[model samples]
Target: MEMNIIETINRFPDQSSCIAYLEGLRWQNEPECPYCKSKRSSKRHETYRHQCHGCNRSYSVLVGTIFESTKLPLTQWFLAISLILNAKKGLSARQLSRDLGVNRKTGWYLQMRIRKAMQEGEDVSLFKGIVEIDETYIGGKKANHSKKKRQARRDNKLQITGYQDKQPVIGLLERDGRIRLQVVDKAHGVTIKPIIEKTVSKDATIVTDGFGGYAGLSKIFREHQVLNKDKEQYARGKYHTNTIEGFWTLLKRGIYGQYHKISARYLQSYLDEFTFKYNHRDNRLIFDVLINKIAAVT
Candidate 1:
């Protein structure tokens, strides 16, 4: 679908049109009973609800999806989904509040629910190709309460410790195909090595920077190369981590520029959201693809 598809969707301002659209997506052949999965079902008082002939249970098209329990108009829900996927840097709850013309709390709740839908599954296969690995720290402002005392007072400030305080992000870029990102536990060898084994194929070439953690991954990867930035070697012949470095640039921009400061607890969801967008950059209908995920089961 094109951007104009959203305009057409806008024409359907009523709930009936929204229900029909959702029905088409939820069921391809016939409107089967969501409860019993029976083809024999009857409409309830011309409403969206349907009754199963076998078990006599009633169900709406949204019973099993993320749309369950939401009271907003289906049209507004679709509009919100489209706006979210169309925006490049991602949207905040306050921004959605103003745009959707809903109360700030409602918008916040809606965005959080949508974020839940964006989360990637754990059992999904890891990325494979010339995968590049890296990590970064994310934390909010530091208080300058007492700017007294000697010896570089800035150094005395409490640095956030553990992967819990600072988000441990690892990115795997598959040459030109797709990028897989995860919030790791730590930057240590034990934490990072297992991820490398899972994501990259044994025959794939792996590129990373000079980190002691990634030292031994060369044995597993077909050709592992390191670009020691301190030694002034960012690239050696065809070996470099620039591709993943470029991804880090986009991620930091989204974090610092757009969202400002995402809490460590919810950092992974945000990373998955960005990674989903990055991997599908080439798809012209990315908005549609992501919206489908909301309807998709785990």
Candidate 2:
């Protein structure tokens, strides 16, 4: 069934229904032993457990998934997924906590686990066609700096500036296709060029702003189109970085408006969440796709 919050709540009224739904998604009708790869299992219907005959071990559908070891009901998890998938900006932990009737910490943990599943693995194919590349900074604005910090900057004593504190994120978008985002240390050629080479195909045309880092891509790609933003030349004929810039706008708005503040330690997860949504924007059954991904995760 096409699942949304209302349908999810009505369909999965209790834990048993949730378990059955998840089991169907994960194991089809045939259960398997997670401890040992044994397909021979007998269902203990009274306890809702699977007894593996080969391994003599009992397990549930959540055995190897993000839901493993979680004490929360599958109903709550399904609700969380619905909220996360439907939220365009994002569902904050505080908001999720209030919605799920759980503590903020639990809500935070749930969101993190779901975000982990959102991560795109390294084995995915590279992007092709006209690819737009750009980089942006994430975090609070420099103008919001405290007076004392501003004074330190004027005194020329504080080597660490507000700009340095802001996280650097690089984004690559395939026209009318998927996007790849990375939390980078710096936006220099040494860092950005290699990512472009590795992620984009040799036949793909590259487009970017007037950044010196991307100047060398012409030698490697079919064509490297540069928009001299310094002179306000954003587009010339069919060449422009508007697509990637649009993605940056969405990302920054989501970061500032939805999340408000994100620590550097977990910035990549936030990136993954946004990238996953952007990549799957066209999917009519995104919720099912996410459920399938959750079931597939080791």
Candidate 3:
């Protein structure tokens, strides 16, 4: 069911209720041992724990999930997930700490674990139909840097250009379907072509900007349409990259306005979080979907 903050609070008022909800989702009323994969288990009536007869080990409903080692209550985890799923620009760690009454470090760690669950594995079907592909850079504008840093850049000591130092993000959006995003070192044809060839079907039409990097796409795709953005030519009837371009706008806005700064090392996790949210925008039960994803991970 679709849930709001009040509904979530009313439904899971305490730790036991939260544990029961998660157990129902994970085991369908039949508890199983995560350690030994045993169906023979007995719940301790006094506590939220199950004992496996096979392994003789005690486990909670949180076992084998992202919340496994978490010391916080399940209610807090559910509340965190609710805030994250509902926030369009994303909830910052500091804001989450204030809202959840947890220490900043605990809030940061919670969000990171949730982001880890947000990652979509590569088991999805290949994209078909007309697909729009594009690449963008993620970094602060050169003008935003200090004068000394800009001077160092001008002297060629620091690489501050769009094609250098900045993190490159490539996106492919299938019309009326899902999107795929990746962080690449370079957007050269050698790097981009293989990803397209592997993730997209050869029978699908490809739409991209007039970049030399996509010059060889015609040989692989059924139809390759290029929008000459440099010449102010955007669309040719059914040929345009505006859809994927719009996605880049949202991504950049969220990164700049919310995150402010993101390290290249963990940028992919941020991408995963955004992509998961975008792909599930229409889902009414997104909170449950995230919990199900965490359950399926192990």
Q: Which candidate achieves the best TM-score against the true structure?
A: 3
Minimum summed lDDT over a 10-residue window in model 2 is located at: 156-165
Extract clashing residue pairs from model 1: none
RMSD of each: 3.7, 2.1, 1.9
Given candidate 3, what's the lDDT at residue 253?
A: 84
Cα lDDT computed for each candidate against the true fold: 0.73, 0.86, 0.86
* Alpha-carbon shift of residue 296 in model 3 (angstroms): 1.9
Clashes of each: 0, 0, 0
Steric clash pairs (candidate 2): none
Summarize candidate 2's per-residue lDDT along 130-188 as a digit string, tens digits: 99999888877777768888788879876655567798888999999999999889888
Tens-digit lDDT track of model 3 for 1-298: 3477887899889998888778888888788888888999888889988889999999987877889988898899998988888878777888889999999999988989999999878888889999999999998777788897788877987666555657988899999888889999888888988888878989999999988989988988899999888899999998888888888888888888878989999899889989889889889988889988887636
- Give the lDDT of residue 262 in candidate 1: 82
Tens-digit per-residue lDDT, 1-298, candidate 1: 3344357376567888877766776675367776667889888997788888988998887887767877888877777766666667777777878888899898877767776776666666656667777777766544412344222444777543343345677777887877777777777889878877876779898888888988888787788888889989988886777888877877787787867888777787777777777777888776557566765543
Point out the higher-scoring one by TM-score: 1 or 2: 2
Residue pairs with clashing backbones, model 3: none
